[model samples]
Target: MAEQIIAALEKIVGANQVLRGDRAKPYLTEWRRAFQPVALAVVRPGNTGEVAALVQSCADFDCAVVAQSGNTGLVGGSAASDARRHVIVNLERMDRVREIDADNATMTVEAGCTLADAQQAAADAGLYFPLTLASRDRCRIGGNLATNAGGLNVVRYGNTRDLVLGLEVVLADGRVWHNLSGLRKDNSGFDLNDLFVGSEGALGVVTAAVFKLYDPVVQQVTALFALDAPEQAVALQRRLIAASGHNLTGCELMSRQAVSLACTHIEGCHEPFEVDHDWYLLVDLASSAQGHWLHEVMAQVVEHARRDGLLSDVVIAHDDERAAALWHLRESLPPAQVAEGASIKHDISLPISKLPMFLARALPAVREALPGVRPCPFGHVGDGNLHFNLSKPAGADDETFLAQSETAHTVVHDIVAEMGGSIAAEHGIGRLKVEALSRYKQPVERDMMRAIKAALDPDNRLNPGVIVD
Candidate 1:
């Protein structure tokens, strides 16, 4: 059966494009090396039609089909976590900027195009695609749509789902569904594009997408400030929004531990303040207005926040080079944590109002459970998401600390539940969080999601065991 399926895919994408054995090694490993993939074959489709045919072939063979994009997902969704010998269909060959309608402020791009490529394409046409992630240079647009990724700019431009106007998807049964409309106001029956945006390739394969664009920011200001606590960060956001309005494009917070680790482990990282503080916020404001008004407004907002006790100290950038340097502290955190040692990571979200309390309690509880455990809790505080990660104690056994991963997860998740937060935030529920989703989601909500899955992919051929029972 696997041979017949391979033959059918090879006929569609040529034998050279159908990879197995040594050639399949690259597609089998997750970005974080969390698991090993046991895929039957890695099929590289060049276009939407090829992807459609691959899906149909897998369905006919009664085999599972997993559609992968850049394979940069933190969760096990983008890679085959299970030992299932399913066929892996990756869109690396389908990369292309089909069209960029500058007049309509939209760009049509294939899923294989990297996020950075999409941003550059828009810039060439004097427009801007505002989906900015740390992995933008490597992460593809299709994968961004698949997980609805949120980045530093999400506080203003929103998630990948919000930037998309339409999608060109290949459904479970190999039928191509083309709804690549660029209209901003469509009173259609249902917003079908959204159904697949955050579906994580369970319902279908996102071959291409139509993304909304924005006017490029000509004036900007960035600063790094110290805050006493998470609650103060929230207070600062409120004050800045009131003063700057939509021009405030980015706001990121880092714990003192996260800052210390990043600065020490990652080179070229320097503290922006004269004295160390418990927390730090990286604030940025962008505008299309002319002159130096953007910087002036941001400086004024900082004074207001300080007056309200939301801000303790600040260092505003005087030039573009200085602004980029400030952003380096926030972007280099994840790699620094990895450099420290083996760690348990969580992509979770909570109400901004409860940010301070959740951190205040959860940090102490985890430290108590595993003495000397280093917790680096930081992320998009304005958007209510935190990358709550824990490093093993000094000179501890790696295998033993990882062995208690479940216990640590439970402790953190319990705190999240008490604060009415979600265990999975920007990251979707791939195989990694399927069990957690079942435990946290309401019974009715779970049933409804499963029903939709059953209706769309009746035979469960498309990325099975993800987001459903």
Candidate 2:
């Protein structure tokens, strides 16, 4: 049966594209080297037709399929375990920017195109695809759509799901669902495109998508402010929202620990303020209007926050170079923490208002559970999502700290649940949080999700062991 399936896939997309045995070892592990899994073969299909054919072949042989793109995912969603029972369909070869409609403000891009490539294509077309994550250079569009990635610009442009106009998905049964319309208004039933956007390749494999683009910003301002506490950051966020309205683009929360790590590890990164505070807020404002004075608006926001005592010190970027440097500090937090040592990372979300309380409860509880653990919490606070990662104490053994991940995760996730938060936010519930979903999700909700998975992929051939059993 395995041979038949392999032969069928080879027939669809040449033998040269099908990697087996020792050749497929590289695709079996995740980017962080945290999870490794064996796969029968890693298949690279060049287009939607080839992907559809591969899916059909897997269905025929009752072989489980795992869709992989870029292999840059933090979660083990793309790794295939046990090759005898699993096959990896890598979309790296499917990269192509099919069309860029400047007038409609949309771009039709293949799933394997890098996020950086998509952004550059949009820029070339004099538009913007604002899903800018740190992994933009390596993460593919399909992976971003699969995860419904929320990045720095999500405060204004929304997530990857929001930016997508339509998708071209190859369903579990090898049937292609081509709903790639760039229409702004469609009262179409079900909106099936959304199902696969954040499905994590469980329901189907995304081959291509039509993404909504935005007018390039003519004026922008980035500012960093030191705040007394999370509450001050929240208050400042509200104040900035009221003052700037739609012009406000991003609001990121950074702990003193996060800032210190970035300064210590990331070269050319410095503290934004002289006096270190408990927390900091990185606020960005962008405007499409050509002559809009974003700098003046930013100045007003800083003045208001100061008068209100929500902010202690502020540093506004005077030019592009300064803005880039300020953003570098925030983006470097993750890598710096990694360099420090093994960290138990939690990408969770809660209500914007409940953030302070959530942190207040979760932080102390986590510390108590894992003594001397450093809490390095930071992320898109404006969108109510926080990374909430915990770094090991200085000189602590990496394996020892990682072994206690469950204890630390439970401490944090319990507080998040109490606040009606999601355990998996921008990052979908890949293999990492499947158990959490089973535990925290309401019985009926889980049943419904299961029903959907069963309905779409009855044989469980598409990305098995993802969101569903």
Candidate 3:
């Protein structure tokens, strides 16, 4: 049966495109190397029609299909775990920039195109894509859309879902739903494109997207400031918002521990400030208005914050090189933590007003549960999302610390719930968070998700065990 399916896929695409045996080994595991599944073969489709045919073939063969993009996802949403019953459908060959409408401020791009590639295309057209991520050079647009990625520019441009205008998806039955319209406002019923935007391939495989663009920022002012605590950071953010209004583009928080780890472990990194503080914020202001002086505005805001005791120290970027250096510290947190040792990671969000309170309570409880654990909390303070990660104590065994992930997660998640927060903020409920989703998701909401999954992919062939039971 597997052979027959491979033969059919080969006929549709080509023998060279149908990977088997050693060639298919790489597609069997996920990015984190946490989940591995065997598959009969992996198929690389070159076009939407070919993808549709591949899906139809897998359905006819009663085999599960997994859609893969750049394979850079932390969640196990792209690879086949059980090869005997699954076939990997890779979109790497479908990478292409279909069109770019600079006058309309939009771009139509294939799902397999890397995020960096799409951003460059927009930049070359004198526009900005504004979906910047650490893995932008390797992560594909399809995966970004599937996960509804939120990155540095999300404070300004919003997440992948917000930037997307339309999508082309391959349904379970090999039907293509082409709703790739560039309309800014559509009163159409259901808004089907949204259903698949963050579905993690449970409903369909995203093949292409029409994304909204923004005018390039003519002037950007960035600064790094030290705060006494999370409350001070929150206060500064509020003040900046009140002053700059919508011009405030990026606002990220960092702990002293997080900063130290980045500087020590990651190359091309150094401390931005001379005096050490418990917390730091990297703030950016972008303006398109002519004759706008964002630098002066930033300075005024910082002065006010200092007077109010919201800031302990502040340094406005004097040059482009200095500004980039500050950002490097912020972006290096993940890799730095990895180098330190095993980390218990949580990407959570709370109300903007409740952030200080959430941290105040959760921090103590987390320390009590795991004594001497290093709490490295930092993220987008403006958006109320924090990557509150805990690193194992010095001389502690990795296995011993990892074994307490449940206790740490419970302490953090309980505080989040008390503060009316979400457990999973930007990252979707992939296989890693399925159990957590089941625990926290409301009964009605879970039922709705299950019903939608059952209705769309009746056989549960599309990326099984992700976003659904």
The lDDT leader among the candidates is 2
Listed per candidate, the RMSD to the true structure in angstroms reads 1.3, 1.2, 1.4
TM-score of 1: 0.98
Could you give candidate 1's per-residue lDDT for residues 1-469 as a string of tens digits? 6677778889999999999889998888887777776888889999998898888888777778888888888887867644435888999888899999988999999999999999999999999899999889989988899899999999889999998888899998889988887888888688898899889989999999999998998988998889888888888787777787667789898999889888999998987788999999998888777778877788788777777788889999999999999898899999998888889999999888888889999999999988889999989987899999998898888889998899999999989988899998888888888888888888999999989999999998888877786
* Total backbone collisions, model 3: 3
| Local accuracy of candidate 2 as per-residue lDDT tens digits, 313-340 | 9888889999999999999999999889
Tell me which of candidates 2 and 3 scores higher on lDDT: 2
The residue pairs that clash in candidate 2, if any, are 39-83, 40-83
Model 3 TM: 0.97
Q: Candidates' lDDT values, in order?
A: 0.88, 0.89, 0.87
**Predictions ranked by lDDT, top down?**
2, 1, 3
Which segments of model 3 are wrong by more than 4 Å?
Answer: none
Clashing pairs in 1: none
Q: Please provide, for model 3 over 229-276, each residue's C-alpha lDDT reduced to its tens digit, 9 standing for 90 to 100.
A: 888878887777778767878899999999999999999988777778
